[model samples]
Target: MGISAAGRAEFDQCRLIDQVLNRLGNAMAINRLIIAEGKDSTAVAAASDSLAEQNESYRRTKRQRAKAGCDGWQRD
Candidate 1:
């Protein structure tokens, strides 16, 4: 038998979540590399601050999407 519509939707949601998590992991790795390769404290701090802002923005967008029922998962 084939999967139901709900099941397929759940599968798609899970896949999207995994893809998001993978991208976060890759971003963290890149941030680490930046810090490790930086020559001075100021350089590292600036990069860290920029990355932190980007992460916060991403989180804010996700929260907005979730609130609007636009994210993959059902809210209610």
Candidate 2:
């Protein structure tokens, strides 16, 4: 029972990881467009700060999952 519950939790986490990967791709494209626009310096700075935090969190999760022996994940 405990083992099945753990497996289910891991499956949920894998789904989350996939979602994060998709959002990260979107974030990259948004960042590029913001850079190209070259407007709203303060807003861009704030957004960049927020993105840095999110990137750190995403990386942390990826690292933790990797340590847990999760597979099929890669980072650029």
Candidate 3:
């Protein structure tokens, strides 16, 4: 059995449409993943900056306390 010319053309057109839709869906998914990763990295960077600032502040306070002789320890 053989497919008619018209039927084969219709099948080809359907196959092309399916391929385009699949590619579009994959592109959208990849774009979403990239955006999510960017947001996560930004959040992590902000948290890291905050932690570093807090650590610096703590160190400054410790130095002041030691300088005032309230730490009961000598700085060398």
Best by lDDT: 2
Rank by TM-score, highest first. 2, 1, 3
- Tens digits of per-residue lDDT for model 3 on 6-41? 767756665555555455455545545555576677
TM-score of predicted model 2? 0.61
Clashes of each: 0, 0, 0
The lDDT of each candidate is: 0.69, 0.72, 0.56
Candidate 3's TM-score reads 0.48
**What tens digits encode model 1's per-residue C-alpha lDDT throughout 6-41?**
878766765665567567667766776788898878
TM per prediction:
0.58, 0.61, 0.48
lDDT of 2: 0.72
Better of 1 and 3 by TM-score: 1
Misplaced by over 4 Å in model 2 are 1-6, 73-76
* Better lDDT candidate (1, 2): 2
